[model samples]
Target: MEIKAIITGCTGMVGEGVLHECLQHPDVKEILVINRKPCGITHPKLKEIIHNNFYDLLPVATQLHGYNAGYFCLGVSSVGMKEDAYAHVTYDLTMEVANTLAALNPEMTFCYVSGSGTDSTGRGRSMWARVKGKTENGLLKLPFRAVFMFRPAYMHPTKGMQHTQKYYKTLSWMYPFFRKFFPQYVSTLAELGQAMINVTIYGYPKKVLEVKDIVAAAAITGK
Candidate 1:
């Protein structure tokens, strides 16, 4: 089955990486990216829609049909923000978009980029984890063909990508050490992207995937 995917957060690092992989992969036939601003990319397989408001996607609902995959990579850091404020974006915004996709494409396979240490119980002390858990829980309840939550702790940025975080320059050198020592907590951005794509095409045994699971999924051959 060919993949016609709607990818969110392309202007960000994770989304951009996933988009890059989809562009090169043979099974991904089409990609639609919705962003508040231009991601500055152009390709025959890519269609970009610049919509300022994610909360209300009614304006572009007509154009979002027929896709079979949804990669929800949009998110925000909870630093210095109150619980309610963080949850508004982390949980509310995500659910709104996921619901929109679930309605438009009932057969869509949704992949969400959560993080390591996410509290599935929703009662964790970390505010961000709690909000993410709520988001994951909410997504699983959506009426889609499948849903997978990816929890990656530290992802080494793909070389030559423009959206890499500024701090990676200082910390990226530690990736080898982490990969050898704390293997469960570290993976490359390429692995995360490939894992999402692979899981969309070939289902995994679990709904929630951690760094090790992501690594294992990335190695799954599509051939």
Candidate 2:
């Protein structure tokens, strides 16, 4: 069966990689992208919905149905932001999108690109981790056919650039070295994209897949 997909954060590094993978797949017939700004890419199968605020999507909630999968990749760095401001972006914005999509398409598979070391225990001191964990938990609670939280560490991209991810970008270049020394904490962007597409296409029995599991799944699928 042909699959239709919705992608948030299409301008980001990982998001762009996933977008490329989805477009390349013959199984994916259409890809709807929602972002604050334009992704600047034009394709016959791609639909870009430019919205200044996520809350504005409520009016078009009914139009979001029938998608086979959704990739929620939108996120912001916690640097220089207050706790409430950070939470609003990391937790509130995510929940808003998840809830809207869940209501519109209960049977859709939701795949979230979460980072490593997310504190599922909401009581953790790290505000970012806690917010991520909360968002992950909330997404799982929704009525989707399947919900997957992909916690990837040191994602090395195949293309594009993320100037903000300076440290990770540098580490990405040294991925070969990092993999040799600490294979457990790293995964390539192509691998991560492949794994997410596989999960959305084939589905997983579990609710969450940590960094190691994501890498393992990616390796298995890539081969």
Best by lDDT: 1
Worst 10-residue lDDT window for candidate 1 reads: 162-171
Clashes of 1: 0
Model 1, span 124-205: residue lDDT tens: 8998998999999999999999999999988999988989988775789998998999998999999998998899999899
Residues 65-139, candidate 2, lDDT per residue (tens digit)? Answer: 789789888888788888899988888888889888888888788999888889898999998888889889988
Name the runs in model 1 displaced over 4 angstroms.
none
* Candidate 2 local distance difference test against the native: 0.81
Q: Give the TM-score of candidate 1.
A: 0.98
Off by over 4 Å in 2: 160-164, 220-223
Cα lDDT for residue 144, model 2? 88
Q: What is every candidate's alpha-carbon RMSD to the true fold? A: 0.9, 2.1
At residue 134, give the lDDT of candidate 1: 91
